[model samples]
Target: CSNGGLEGANNGKITVPAGVTSFTITTPTVDDDLKEDTEAYSISVGGVDATGTILDNEEDIEVSSVTSDTQTEGTSLVHTVTLSGEAEAAKEYDFTFNNGTVEDEDIGTLQFSNGVTYDASTGKITVPAGVTSFTITTPTVDDDLKEDTEAYSISVGGVD
Candidate 1:
């Protein structure tokens, strides 16, 4: 009646009544928000052992957030995309520039680090291993058509 010495589980002692054939042990699931491989643990009773495996349910690349302040017209609107967890491999993502109050031409070529670049023609970016954050820069056109402040957003899409 032990917890198999697992970190996410609790240790316990169970009393088995005479003539009881079997009992149940509960293994609690832990949400660590980290991508990991399957982990195994063993439960021993009277020199006999039983093994159990915990499957990782977390995403390879955690959710991403765009961090940037309001930009002045004619300056590059730099959006820094950040991932939450450390990646074991390169993480590829697709993003799109959504127009709110700006025109399509207002967005320029998107530039990234490590020689990675994309424009309106392509919609993908790859974050290399051991990298958690990267920036994408695109110039905003300062048009003569004077209106209110233009609002736009870069929408990060599916992961690969």
Candidate 2:
């Protein structure tokens, strides 16, 4: 008794036509357990217009079972870095990262992109899924001998 129940059959359902009034149903970011009692999912909508009219709207997708307060993202999450001098052996060095507050960076550094990845043993740096912000391209070690300006420090602990 389900063709697109809970919007999970490959997530293929959402057609708007016949005057195009309005439509918007987007829900993402689900990770909060400790359920004491509260969880629901039911957004039924069968449509038909442009001569053959019929639109059913029985919406309801409430999920609120607090107890954990939502804070679980520690799959070995790591992004530690530190460097402030020592690079003048072969040349080729350029440091750029700040985090004054974010949105431009200045405090320590952090303004990543959409698809990120950096794991040198476990210094995890994977902010996948429509990344919000990320930027840490540490690569260019020449160590020739002629250094003077070196600086870097990125530390983002796991969110338990």
Candidate No. with top TM-score = 1
For candidate 2, the C-alpha RMSD (Å) to the true structure equals 18.3
**What tens digits encode model 2's per-residue C-alpha lDDT throughout 65-155?**
1111111121111232222222212111122233222222212223333445545466555544322233343333333445444434444
Model 1 alpha-carbon drift over 4 Å, by segment:
1-59, 114-122, 158-160
Worst 10 residues of 2 by lDDT: 63-72
Task: Give a tens-digit lDDT track for model 1, residues 74-127.
Answer: 898777777888665666667776677887777676678654445446666666
TM-score of 1: 0.54
lDDT of 2: 0.33
Candidate 1: clashing pairs of residues: none
For each candidate, what is the lDDT?
0.67, 0.33
Number of backbone collisions per candidate, in order?
Answer: 0, 20
Each prediction's TM-score against the native?
Answer: 0.54, 0.20
- Give the best candidate by lDDT: 1
